[model samples]
Target: MSYPFGCIVVGSGHAGCCAALSAVEAGCQRVLVVEKGPKEWAGGNGYFTAGAHRTVHGGLRDLLPIVQNVTPAAVATIDMEPYSSEAFTTDIMRLGGGKSDPEMVSAVVGGSRDAVKWLAEWVHVPFILSFNRQAYLVNGRQKFWGGMVLSVEGGGKGLIAAHQQALEREGVDVWYETPAVELILEDGHVTGVVVLRNGQRIWLRASAVILACGGFESSPELRAKHLGSDWSRAKVRGTPYNTGDGLLLAQFAGAQLTGDFAHCHSTCWDANAPDDRGDRELSNQFTKSGYPLGLMLNAQGHRFVDEGEDFRNYTYAKFGREILHQPGGYAFQVWDSQTIKWLREEEYGDDVVKKIWANDVAQLADNLISEGLEDREAFINTIAAYNAAVQASQRERREVRWDPAIKDGLSTQSSQQFLALPKSNWALTLEQQPFLAVKVACGITFTFGGLAIDPETAGVISASSGEPIPGLFCAGELTGGIFFGNYPGGSGLTAGAVFGRKAGREAAKLAEDIYN
Candidate 1:
């Protein structure tokens, strides 16, 4: 039998794009990419991301070569700290609660820098230093924080466009509206894929198959089945087409599932966003990440999470569950004029969401009642008590040095006495006039569990024999054992590229070995 293609890639997200290109570079002459969505919905969940990628770097000098937007003057004004491979691994493990696989974490960390460089040079992705999102002008210098400092010029849209251009240049065939229905197995080894195209089931033979489709976050049924019933109601923050096709296909081929199925990468999103789908235009703008700069309170006028706990990306993923667990499945983020101007315009601009403003504490609480504050008295009392605690903490600290780029020791509770829950970082008292607030709800990004794969080759592991399913590779969100309960921000895309590159190169080798 003559095989039509050397390798077939399922899914057309960033991971799949990376895999396809790698396969082509590895000598795969006939490679095809299958995308479940139509041409308009091509990039999968990656289309709705902020396009930030986390990678290890030797400070600014090392990163200057890959980034396209930074100038020499801007570089002198920027003060970025070096992120070591050890630091990256420790951060991932810490955020995952020490449940992340050491091997996978090591692979991602070791490969991240090169993966980012390849994306910038090979794919021509418009890379920029994350000055607006990650840095603050502290002491007349741009200080980048949280160990993440790179993003696409136009976020996900720009990233997808760059990948598309690269694919076109490489002469790869991308079939939109073609969904992979099942894996074609021969003697317990995947040989091809059965796809539904033009309302017909067509079998395409290939030497190797790589699955890079995303997780099951878009499927309410899978969310309820694997992540819990409450997740069924959570708003999807990305493409609605990611219904776990690759995950299901791998399972049907006897792939073993690993990682935490009950958890996901969720965030505080706009409470008013559409429940089932995400806006292609607004995209991640619905995310309410400014909670770290202010206070997040439930309907009953109580602080449920430490808004100042760690950096926003480090804690934002898990905070969505905290908001979902609150009464009525929603919460409100409040900030006074003291911190309102500092909120990121990309997320909290006037046209993005309805912003309620008030002049005083009582008026703010009264206005919030219309927005969902349960008790006016409780809201006022909570603000008063929080203000008092902030004053107390300031007095004990003796010096007030508030820096957004660093864990500015400024806090709301101190030695003499502290609240049951303390704001551990930038804790300016929210007493300034004209307070602002916005309603927020949980926005599910992607699930935490998927098919177990070899960290080196991205080959899916078989459930029956604890061995790789030959010629069946996996990447992206479908490949699990990387993340657990929580994930560090920007790590997902980097991990996807790292493993996708591996899967592509290995699949090309396997195909050459079989067909050449």
Candidate 2:
């Protein structure tokens, strides 16, 4: 059966759902969403997140409306810092190495709060303060830091459910297991989509089409081609369905591909994770991000990157690539009793494998050798040197400044004398008993490269003309130029919502003008 529509959105992830809903609201009577995966796996990478969203907010009061957990009593005990548009813009530009499109960055940062508010007010999605990940207790007061303040109730899966509910409420029809194979371009503009649904190919005509499918993070071939030869060794953190379908579809329709092809959003994940894209049960548990509190060593028992280079959020994305580039694509995050509690709750889960523990550092070193630690003495000596530096820093009165809420100056000095890679902050003495080490591998979230689009309208830009295609558009990870080498925490969801809404609305207007 063939059904013509005014607007057709490929991929039912956060971006596609938002686009479909916004298109219906913008007077597109027959807006439809086509997802490659089944209904159970609908949300894409957004489903695997902690659901944190970075936005410009006045403070706790401004967030109270959307955050269900915030109460008057809870507000007084926490320091909810305001994240302004300027700060958001700065973080995006700085983390992206100033390589991101300034106009898209401005649109994302300026519209972040409104996007979150739209999710709550218009889309009816519920959010709450991300207390577990973004806050720390100081003198009996919980202080929120790191610029992230809110998350959907059950995290990313909850967010997808919310979007599904909103789509159902708005009467937006969604076709599961329907993959858009190609875009039908006519007169130099996108006019329809050829989709593979239920073992049959159908050409669905539309006035406008929005490519919100996602990036090429799950494609091993593409990863090896663009993200270096070692990239295929990295674990896929999200949906395997996102294999560059959107990028290929858009490029075939004359869209300009932009952004950093060699870089992607990655993190330290469990080395034992399956080769395919991980599921919801594993969720964010694949991450082992407590390295700032301790240390990360390669297979040789030698540290490779600076573990405490910055807050985990600021550095986790890039460090995973470092791990992948390491010999055998493996690393271990080691911690002691002193910093064990500082680890995220995900680390202790049953899903994590190759967790080694011992009463002291020497036993820990011996146990690690079986797991591919080539040099036992080198590992022990490295720990000893790191401990000595921590003790020296403690003697210098840096102990009083030892606070985890912010970057305390608790760093190492002598470790630099003995080791190539040294801890830069939170260099606590690993002198405590029962040292713990967990196996880690590189987990790629999404690629930072895709089709370029206009920031104002979310319309795909033609490579030849350098102008927007009449009815072609994109959002989410499919639209590049907003992120490059690195990404700010929680900005992915915000970008999807902001640009998704814009693409949907613009596509609807185009459909009304051209097809009506």
What is the Cα-based lDDT of residue 296 in candidate 1? 88
> Could you tell me how far off, in angstroms, the CA of residue 215 lies in candidate 2 after the best superposition?
0.8
- TM-score per prediction, in order, is 0.98, 0.97
Report the Cα lDDT for residue 448, model 1.
87
Those runs of model 1 whose alpha carbons end farther than 4 Å from true positions after fitting are 1-3
lDDT of 2 at 384: 84
How high is the CA lDDT of each candidate model?
Answer: 0.90, 0.85
Model 1: lDDT of residue 447: 89
**Cand. 1 TM to true fold:** 0.98
- In terms of TM-score, the best-performing candidate is 1
Clashes (candidate 1): 0
* Collision count for each candidate, in order: 0, 0
Question: Compared with the true structure, what per-residue lDDT tens digits does model 1 show for residues 1-516?
Answer: 334788999999999999999999899879999999999998988888889999999999999998888887887888999999999999999988899989999999999999999998888999899887888887899999999999999999999999999999999999999999999999998999999889988899998899998999999999999988888889999988889888889989999999988899999999999998889899989999998789988999989998888988899999998898888889999999988888999999999999988999899888989888897898888878888898999999977688888898788888875789889999889988889999999999998899899998899999999999998998888878888888899999999999999999998898789776
Per-residue CA lDDT of model 2 for 114-156, tens digit only, reads: 8999999888788989877788777898878778888888888
- TM-score of candidate 2 relative to the true fold: 0.97
Candidate 2, clashing residue pairs?
A: none
